[model samples]
Target: MYADVTVVGAGPVGLVLAAELALSGVTVQVLERLAEPETSMKAGGINVPTAEALDRRGLLPAAERVHRETMERMGAAFGRKAGAGAGAAATPSDGRGAGAQRQMTGHFAGMVIDAGLVDWDDPDLAAHAAVAGARMVPQRELEGLLATHVERLGVPVRRGVEVTGFEDTGDGVLVSTTAGAIRTGWLVGCDGGHSTVRRLAGIDFPGTDAELTGRVAVVDMADSSVLDEGWVWSSRGAYRRGPQPGRVFTVEFDAARRDDAENAGTRPHRGAPAEPVTLEEMQASLRRVSGTDVTLTALHGAATRWSDNTRQAATYRSGRVLLAGDAAHVHSPFGGQGLNLGVGDAMNLGWKLGAVVAGWAPEGLLDTYDTERRPLGAWVLDWTRAQAGVMRGDAKSVALREIVAELLATRSGATYAVKKISGVTQRVEVPGDHPLAGRHAPDIRLADGSRLANHSHAGGFMLLDRTPDGAFARAAATWAGRVRSVPDGTDAAGAARAEPAGVLVRPDGVVAWAADEAEATPTAVTALEAALHRWAGAPAHEPVA
Candidate 1:
């Protein structure tokens, strides 16, 4: 079928791209070579910002189901008691109180559940505040949900069809696929790292392979009753542990041989998939390593070798055709950052694509896609490369891992690690020096008991605070519904200990400018308007139109 845009691959990245585009009212099509989405559970977890982004567009419920189900399995295997109280109960600082930690009992004994187990807060009320909380959903399940939503949004998806070739003809793109030939105004290659569209565009992918890294099975078990948590063990007697089951369990094959000097240049990907690794193999490996014998149900296998081709296309646009997801950048999966990165890419591109299709975006606006995303990709690649090296289990790497992982396990460490892994710590380079610049706002309850941040679209700048004169209302009108304003704060009685009075938040829910009422009228307005123009690619003083 012919359409405005055709996206290849219905994987998480591609589906997310499609859903964002469709939700933004772009006419798009998704093509997948697979007859059906994989049932194999993959993608161990997601980060905070991604959860917020998905929730902003109303897709969190479906996403949470997958995380909830997986975490349940993890809890059982880890010998943990089951209850919603697992993560909901607040722990007292003294470590003893009603809010203190709950203990595991019965079939599961002595296990404790913490913030790590909870699904994120309801997206409707929580997404706009401080990057929100992270929720885990297997990649396949996430993809299926997004694909369904995209189709529901009226964007057509053609399965079992692969694109063989495409030609960019300036005004539009002509695509040839297994299904047939079609023409479109825009073509997006969400296909993957080994993308045909990228190749056809004659773009070069530049980067180097990580040294001595090899493939590992990304296996899943039909039943995880015997397994406790995800663990990574090496011959050096070092392994990284995973969370309890109902959560994800990963078996990394970064096994080191007894004789490093005997190591060869060849790695294992070319080998035929080993018969689902036998239960005995898993039990033996666990016992030999962690002194734990856990039977496993094999799920799927993948190459985890570091393939760090940290490059976006020399350009994101080639006439009407563009690239997104792995087609644009493929890096090591150090922080479970791949899926989250792809989702953000979709969010950034969605609004621009929508504006272009809706006939409001200025010429050259889409070019910013590469300018903004490429550096982000490079940063992730570099950070992950360092992370992978630290996980190597070599003598020095193991020492570093011990120090780092210890820090990661504590409350402070968890917070620090989560922020980095979730992409929350890396602020986007928006143009401004406002107090709220490049930071997420904390969730605040208004005097009326409503949250200031909720399921708002990440397409326009929004001002949220407590002022009746309503400069926000006026600005909202000038932008034709793209800009939104909300008056949110406590009443006088509640204001004694409340935060500052006014805040301007970006479409992505990050606070762009914040101030008390006295400073809100001018300084904050200037900053908010400046952020709008920066993201919208217009002059700071230009009219909202």
Candidate 2:
């Protein structure tokens, strides 16, 4: 069989990438090694950037419904009011009340950053005000949601088809799987860390060794009262009580010691072991971290192991072969950055790769995917590494945690942390001096009352023209086939904020160019024309009907 793109791994990232590619008129298929989706718990929530991406695709409502159902299940399991004790509580000093803290933006190490302290009034943060905040949707539910969406888009997801190998020909890729072989124009590895596709493609994944080992599981305990209700740091390590009843997490900082004994001097084991985690092992780890003999009667599902073994690929692409999601980078689950980072990679790369396959990509367009996303991946690696350092059981780390806690309590510090954790502060390095340039476009409300997000559901570039005479829209006509123009309407609140007269927004919601003047001058129109060529490629020979 032949396809435009063959995505290896049917997880959320792969599914989202498949949907994006299909929306861009590219034929895509997804392959999964597992016959059924795993029920293991991962990424209990998604951050702000991921939430906005879902919203852009009209998938947020379904995701929100799933999140509500998950919360209700947890509430019933905990035998408490719905949504109680699910996330960090608001500090009395911040004074935004219970409503604000419920958003649960993110945490550094185990220190939960209270959402109440975030300065929404900050000009830098204004973009997020229109978009939804973070939501608590487990990984499995998200995968299911995206799977349905991808199927509706007419993309087939073949199960039990393990991609054993592949060769990237100059023009296409020939994939060898357990089921059979298939040829495709492009191959993307959205598989988890230890990806077969990455290994086969010979991409370099270089980074730090593991520092601590952590285990999370849902267990029935004979006496659960011994453990604290939230995260507790001790001299040995740290442990967390319920975000859901019977859900326990423990981390032990003995990785270096274990590595020294096992590897002698080489690198420590980079990921979790292949063997299943036994009941005895869970009890022992709980005892070591909590200093309490909590007897685990039984494990409900599979127990998973993780570590702070952060790493990123040297590059994201190799000929017809490329990488996204966990296949591109790996780190500890701290700050809940892994899934969000992967989703961002897919959003940034999907449209570019689709353009490449569709024969309209500008020169060096696919290269920008690496230039824009690799640094973000590198930042996340260091971000998780920093959290790992602060989470160490040593006295120095404890002192450092104390300082970080103090900083987290202040307004400036909380705002900065929330900005980073929510991903609102991340900006692409696209060339432009406008404040909104290279940044995620704010969901501006047009005069017709339709928001910018309403126009982005089709997965195409947009020229939001607020010019009184539709000057910018007229200038962008040459690229009308590739870019949709919304003219003859003013931004409902753009005037108040002194927003640009016209702005060019990419398929992924990034602002490519903007005109600050109230009217589009000859010079401004020329710049807009140049941006269209740079991002949308050469204008179509005939204007789109």
Candidate 3:
């Protein structure tokens, strides 16, 4: 098969990127060894940034609805509010929906943020942000949703097709898979930690080694009541057993005992006996970690083991081959940010790759993918690594956990955790002096009462004008096919969230540039053109000077 781009792996990240490129009218193909979506939702959480990315693609409402229904039912079952569950959904009185809520609480390493101590909302900053909280959608279902969406966009995804190898011919990439050979302009490895594409491209997966092995399972318990529903930390280890009966999750941080099969080693047996795990072994680990008699009756499916081992690719790209998701980085899912981070990687890389493949992106635009995203990957790696230090059930770790929990209970302490864990604090560096520059633009309400993101479903830069002067419009017209000029209900500069006189939003929803509302000097117009040239490439006809 011949395509503009070939996405390796049919997981959520790969599918999202594929759909994104396809939506931009690019010919793309997805290759995966898994013929079908896995029945088990391996990942159960997605952060707010990812939620916003999905929203921009017009994919969030349906998934959010599914999540809301799930939460509503869970709320009924758990006797809690619809939005009280982890990564839950809540209806807001204002236009921002859940993103507008005032106070929220999040847990970091067994410690819950104290809402009374911390504002959680951070009103001053929340307005300009995209999403307020996360959505607890399972990986299996998320994959299904994205797969279906990509298919609808006319992107063909070939399952059970393992990408064995590839060669970057200095012009295009030649991909070899078990099914056959294919040609594409670019290839992205969205495969998991053990990525074949990353290996073929000779990228280094460097980071700290695993300090502990965490185990989880899906089984019928003899006495389910003994298993705790949410998260609980003890002298032994940490776990979150329920909120769904028979879907048991456990963790024991003892890398020392990983190889001993009797000790409940790492990785699942995939429901097969002697994949080096047993029901007896899982029960033992549970008892040892939980210090409870939570007996296992029958093992339905899971006997998987995970680790806090963190690794990241030295770089995100190798010639025509690029990496995303676990292929780019791997960490323990302790903070439940794996799906969120991977999805964010897709959002960040998708637009730049789409732009480059479409021939409108500036020189080195594709290079920025590695420059911008790799740092975020490294930060998350450290974030998860620090969480691991808090999680290990040991003398020092327990004492440290106590201190961390105490600090997290304070306003200053909780704010720090909430921002980082929620994926809310990222500000990718872009050229420009405006504080809003290089940040994800706010969800601004436009003149027609529609949100700014609504106009971005079709790709291209967006110029939201607040000034009466047609200067920005004149500038945007230079990049006719590249930038779309639109008017907002309020002045773009003084709009709801400290907006500028004008805002140039990248197709990926990042604020490329912001005009100073206070000044419309010749300098302002000149600055605007410079911003356009830097981001949107050189203007056509020099604005007919």
Top candidate, metric lDDT = 2
For candidate 3, the lDDT comes to 0.71
Q: What C-alpha lDDT do the candidate models reach, one value each?
A: 0.55, 0.78, 0.71
**Model 3, residue 529: C-alpha shift (Å):** 2.2
lDDT (Cα, tens digit) per residue for candidate 2, span 1-545? 78999999888889889999998899999998888887665777777678778778877667666656666777787786555553522122111122423455567788877667777676666655443322666777787888888988999999899888888888899999998999999999987787778788988877778878888888999988888877899989999877766888888888643322112111111132345667898899999988887888999887777777777887899898999988888877878888888888898988999999889999999999999998889999888889889998888999999999999988899888888887878888987788888888775656665667777788899898878778888888888667899873444555423456789999888899998887778988988988898999988766657
Q: Write the per-residue lDDT of candidate 1 for residues 111-138, one digit (tens) a residue.
A: 1223452223322223233322225455
Arranged by TM-score, best first: 2, 3, 1
**Predictions: Cα RMSD each:** 7.3, 4.3, 3.9
- Candidate 1 Cα outliers beyond 4 Å, as residue runs: 83-134, 212-232, 236-314, 362-364, 402-414, 440-444, 453-461, 489-507, 510-520, 536-545
Count clashing pairs, candidate 2.
Answer: 0
TM-score of 1: 0.75
Superposed Cα deviation of residue 190, candidate 1 (Å): 1.1
